[model samples]
Target: MTKTEKTKQFIIEKSSVHFNKIGYLGTSLRDITNLTGLTKGSIYGNFENKEEVAKAAYKYNAKRIGNKIISALNQSPSGAINKLMAIVDFYKNNWSVIIETGGCPLLNAATESDDAFPKLNIEVRKSFIGFTKIFEDIIKNGIEERIFKHDLNIKEYASTMVMLIEGGVLLSKTMADKEYLNISLKRIENLIHNEMKL
Candidate 1:
């Protein structure tokens, strides 16, 4: 990467956690400057505005978690059901890492960007939709392999899994209670085993 590209990425890496932790409205230009040790002028020289920085930061945060999930999914054994279990264990095992870093980036961005940050709102929504499709694809493949029930409502269940997982993240973060997320995830795992499994 060019010096300019590397500098922009450096700023994104440094400020991404802060943005996800506090949020768009909560984060200030000073925060970015302070976190990255870059002057306001230098930061602005790289980006058009605070909104642009925020959009890029959110992408960085989301991709970090996505990479973790993808890695876990790829390493799982052949069965589709095992693939789904790998996703569950991925979240469960990474809870500490995620919570320490300021919780799920998509949830954090979506909640904070609801009205004030329109561009970010679109990005956050797309992230959730993409995540939901991962579950849908896994379940569909499981059914094709006769490892999961054929009548599963792919759309509803996939959407619910994403929604519930995000909700658990919020509760866990706010309450500082891992049990909140643990309970919700248990429910999801139960559905996968008892209801979906063949």
Candidate 2:
């Protein structure tokens, strides 16, 4: 990468955790400067302002979480059911890691970005919708392969699945109880096996 790109990337990487752990309004330019050990002008030189950096940091954080699930999906064996289960397994395994980073990025962004950061709130919404697409694709493939019920409501199921997962993460993080998240995921598993599966 070029020097400019590298420096911007450095700022994003350094500030991502800070933004995720704090919020858009909670994090300050000074916090980023402190985290990156860069002067205020240097940070401003790389980013238009703190808002721009926060947006990139949100995306960076979201990508980190998404990549984990994508890796799980890639390593998973064939069968739509197995892929679906692999998603559940990914969440179960990654809960601690996610908790350390101050909960899920999309959730954090959604809660904080509203009213204050309109663009960011939109990005957060897009991120959640993107999550729904993953489940939709999985279910669609399952139905195509005759692995899932033919009559499944793809949109409803996908949206519900994503909502439940996000809710689970929220509850788990807020309550400091992993079981809440596990229970949510277990319910999802049961929903797939009993209702969606053929």
Candidate 3:
């Protein structure tokens, strides 16, 4: 990467932790400066404002989480059911890492941006909808392959699946208990075996 590109990425990478942990509004330019050991002018030299950096940080954090799931999915068998189960297992196995990274980036961004930051909220909404679309595609493929029920409501099921996963993450993070997420995954598994599967 070029020097400017590297520096921009450096700022985004360093600021992501604080943005994910503290939040968009709560995090400040000073925090970014402290995290990157760069002066305000240097930071501005890379980003237009704190808002721009905040948006980039959110994308970086979301991509980090997305890439993990993509990796897990890639390793699983090439079947819709297997892929769905892989997602559940990914959360089951990586809850600690997820928690350590300041919880789900989607959850954090949505919670903080929903009412306050309209510009950031747009990105958060797109990221969230993108996830639901992933689940929907999986379900659609399952039906086409005769692996899932033919009459299933793909949209509702996909949305619910994503909701349950995020709900569990939120509860688990708030309650400091992994079982909340485990229970949620258990529900998904049960639905897969009993409700969705052919």
RMSD of each: 1.0, 0.8, 0.7
Task: Write candidate 1's Cα lDDT for 69-169 as tens digits.
Answer: 98999999988778877888887898999988889999888888898889999999888888998999998998899988889899988888887788888
Q: How accurate is candidate 1 locally (lDDT)?
A: 0.90
Of 1 and 3, which scores higher on TM-score? Answer: 3
Scanning candidate 2 in windows of ten residues, the lowest lDDT window is: 16-25
- The model with the greatest lDDT is 3
TM-score for candidate 2, please give it: 0.98
lDDT of 2 by residue, 1-198 (tens): 999999999999988888988897799999999999999999989889899999999989998898889899999998889998999999899899999988999999999988889989988988888888999999999999999999999999898888888899999899999999998999999999889988
> How high is the lDDT of residue 94 in model 1?
89
lDDT of each prediction vs. the true structure? 0.90, 0.91, 0.94
Which RMSD does model 1 reach against the true structure? 1.0
Model 2 Cα RMSD, 1 decimal: 0.8
- Candidate 3 residue lDDT tens string, 1-198: 999999999999988988998998899999999999999999999999999999999999998989888899899999999999999999999999889889999999999998889999999999989899989999999999999999999999999889999999999999999999999999999989999999
Distance from true position, residue 43, model 3, in Å? 0.6
Candidate 2: lDDT over CA atoms? 0.91
lDDT of 3 at 30: 96
